[model samples]
Target: MIFLNVALKNIYMFQDAKLDLSYPRKLPSSTVENEWLEDFPKINFKRVLILSGANASGKTVFGKVLCIINNYIAGSSINQSTSWLDIKKVMFDKKKPTSFKVEFLTPKTAQAHKLAVIFDQDGLIEESYTCIDLQRNEPQSAMYKRLREFEPTSYYHKTKNNHDITNAGFTSVAVSQGKMKVPSMWNYRLCEVDNTSGSQGRITAHDTNIIKTFLSAFDSSITKVKSIAAESYKIEFSNGEHVLIDKGKLLDPDRLSRGTHEAIDIAMFYEAMKNESFGESATFYLDEMLAYSHTEAEQSILNLLIDTLPRHSQLFYSTHNYDILDMNLPVHSHVFLKKDKYSEFIQPEKMGYNQNDRSLLGYVKNDVFGTLPSMDAINNL
Candidate 1:
């Protein structure tokens, strides 16, 4: 499944906000080769999104929102709770419901699927799911809906669809077993790729080959990656040196830098993709992906993500690196989050800037986008 858009209200730093990744009605003239999905030509959809902002500007929180949505849709136990204590407290007498709506597409269905949920400090206030007929541009049908005060119902026309009401699970299993093919979702944060020695450490010969390919792209010196045993691997380098990884512990830590650990984490994702571990279509959420990496390595990884990720997959990343602004991504691919405020997309042309001029550094320096940090207080200190 491909993500189209996400809407949020009274959730953390967001207050009635919408982040639309769907292609603009009209593609910006600056769009170039390999920037968009080739199969979905009719729909203007971006496969890569970069969220950048100041230290406390909600970039990571926004990523967490997406993670929460994914978990809910996947029928994870995380969302079946009776109440939510993590909601943002309302400052005024009026309390707003913390809600979010996500829209996505399934490969087998012609309609777009939507899931919306509203909750408060006490519990879930409302939840609903519907399908929209893209061809007719109308609400096609209501799959399932539940209001806090009313009994939940699964509707098909006037009658309830018993098959749809099976309390087994929601979108996750239904999409996989049903006609629609839901997209797989993966989330990565700092240390997850480096320090965590989870299932990712287990590898097959094919997986090792795939990891080698990505590692080679990032560092050609990595001649081979071989799984010696469970949770252990051997990496041979071009300089006739070898390093061993035993149950997530790396021998000779000085040889494999933090950047390599990050790269290995990414390579494991590639291995998963090759093994069809994430399903047909996938969405990857990476937070602070460039941490501890130098400029050249960052650029190399960025290019790797751009060129290597499966065509059907979408990558959403949050970073503080200003160098990314120089990558010349289409305007629609950028989202700027302001602290305690709303997030907005930056359109290069609308701001009277040339896309090819690499003016993002200048724009941020001039505070054109308003996401830059105010360092005046630091100077005073």
Candidate 2:
């Protein structure tokens, strides 16, 4: 399933925060629709999302919340797991039920669904699911209009307890067997500061090559990456510097730079995509993992990912790299997060910056979008 829109409510510090993946209609779409699914020819929803924001603007929080919601949709976890308590003392402090509205597409089923969920500390209290009768070659706007016109009786309200409301998504053999929601192919990776690089998942010859090329771009001192074992890796530096991973744990981690470490984590994500290369649909989110890499290398990686991903997939990338704005990409691909009372996803194209002639980087640098970091504290210090 592909996420089109999502909203969070009643969660502490995250009330009514909406994330939209829809491409702005007013902007001229790419002649080559790499970011759209062929199943919905008239509806060109975004397939690549470049998320940028100031520090403390909730980039990691966005990925974390989406991960939980993905789990909720897949029936892997529900009822707002206690694990969220560690996020913040303020989280879940309110008496109100944590609620969400999710709009997604299950293209294999040839239908789109809108989900409404309300859950308390215990379990799910109320939830509703509505599906649009997808017509062949119908545009998203038209389909939504038809959904609105459809009778209310078609809506599928959850009948059971929260945990059991698992049967909420596409009803397939997987759902019948109590495995998971159908088409559950998604990945979420946190940055090095927020998550440990666990054994750099699914190492392979492909990942090793990609890792070597990527690491070399950032640090030319790195010469080679070779597999030492099923999970171990040997990194050889030209200056005779070496780093070893024995069964996925870095030995003498200080010998490894933060940039190289995150590259390994990113290679893991690549490994994931490689495994799913043949799959129909997938979703991947990487949060600020490219912090140490140069914008040039980021552009290369972004291009490679765009080429590598399946046609029916979307990748959400979060970073503070403004250099990316200089690249010739659609303004709709970007969502800038700024926080006051809560976070807001600002779409430049949606905000009337339609033409590609203007300088996105300049606008951002000049604080036109108001996403530039405030230097007040550091200046005062």
**TM-score of each model, in listed order:** 0.72, 0.84
For lDDT, the strongest prediction is: 2
- Cα RMSD for candidate 1? 6.7
Give Cα distance to truth, residue 329, candidate 1, Å: 2.1
Judge candidate 2 at residue 25 and give its lDDT.
Answer: 61
TM-score of 1: 0.72
lDDT of 2: 0.67
lDDT of 1 by residue, 1-381 (tens): 567778888776677677776653444555334433344445545677888888867776666666656655555433433423133342111266577877776544544666666655544445556664454322212211211223322222112343453343222333434433344455444333232111322334446776677667667799999899875788899999998877646787788777776666666655554445555456666677567677777766666666656656677777888888777677667777776445544444445564554547778778887778889999999
Candidate 2 segments whose C-alpha is farther than 4 A from its true place: 24-32, 79-93, 148-180, 192-206, 239-241
Candidate 2: worst-modelled 10 consecutive residues by lDDT: 194-203
Candidate 1 least-lDDT 10 residues: 139-148
